[model samples]
Target: MADFDEPLCGCLQDMFSCLIVFCVPCGGICIQAYSVDKATSSGMVCPFLWSCCLGCIGSAVNRGQIRQKYHIEGSFIMDCLISCFCGCCAATQEYREVMNRERPK
Candidate 1:
């Protein structure tokens, strides 16, 4: 499986996403969830609530979904760890991955 286009440590590379995550992590996550499935309100709200109540699990699940969609190489355990410790960074990384991959080159 291919790796994510942007590494987790590269979160700071995108100043806009980095600042969004740093200032309002849940909003960052909400943006990601919305991007993934724009048609569904649950897709947006569920992850936002999850991040609010269970930071690691919510973001981990969201990360897993992104990984699955892009066929990126990673595991839920690692996602949980990253989300648990580096929630903002992870969110920013996820945002960058989606934006980079989906945008036309």
Candidate 2:
């Protein structure tokens, strides 16, 4: 099972990210997806487009990528549901995970 530095309750754990996502969903999603993918600006376009136009698909894809990269214990369907229903929270959690991983260990 994949280990997470924090649980999925990013709203409770990360108020800043949660607030950002809540205020500007598209920008927040773009930043979170881009950061998690660890890619250049060109690569950020796809996720940014998807997130801006198709939130469900974008969030699901981003969550799936993060899960696979970290061997997180979750199914694609679950990721979809989370993305569909709890997008802000999910993205915030994913963002936190990426930030945590990037921090010095």
Candidate 3:
């Protein structure tokens, strides 16, 4: 997974460098960039020391637990029923069509 700072840095460079260096830093829902802060912004220097800093923070919040709400039977024949809603055919197209037709009008 690429980080988010690379594209931003590339953009800044392109905007300042007469739009010469084109950097497409994003691929499949992620982007990365490198940024620096100093007494003098070296736009150039690798001239100075290039420092790469990366970090990730993730958190998970649980919504209270609920019991599995399915009728499970111990027979293979019944397994098929559970898989397909106990033999009740899902009228996917009909349902969608009715929902669409009933909208507003």
Estimate TM-scores for all models.
0.82, 0.80, 0.15
Residue 79 of candidate 2: its Cα lDDT? 82
lDDT of 2 by residue, 12-98 (tens): 677777778878747578656665666222366676666777778777877777777777788878888988887777878888887
* Best of the candidates, lDDT: 1
Q: Give the top-scoring candidate (TM-score).
A: 1
* Candidate 1: residue pairs that collide: none
lDDT of 1 by residue, 4-85 (tens): 7787789768888777666763666766666455322245767677666776897788888888888989999998998888
Q: How do these models rank on TM-score, best leading?
A: 1, 2, 3
Total clashing residue pairs per candidate?
0, 0, 7
Which is the winner by TM-score between candidate 2 and candidate 3?
Answer: 2
What RMSD, rounded to one decimal, does every model reach?
2.6, 2.5, 23.0
Quantify all predictions' global Cα lDDT against the true fold.
0.75, 0.72, 0.19
Quote the RMSD, in angstroms, for model 3.
23.0
What does candidate 3's lDDT look like per residue over 24-81, in tens digits? Answer: 3221001111111111133323311211111110000000000011121133333333
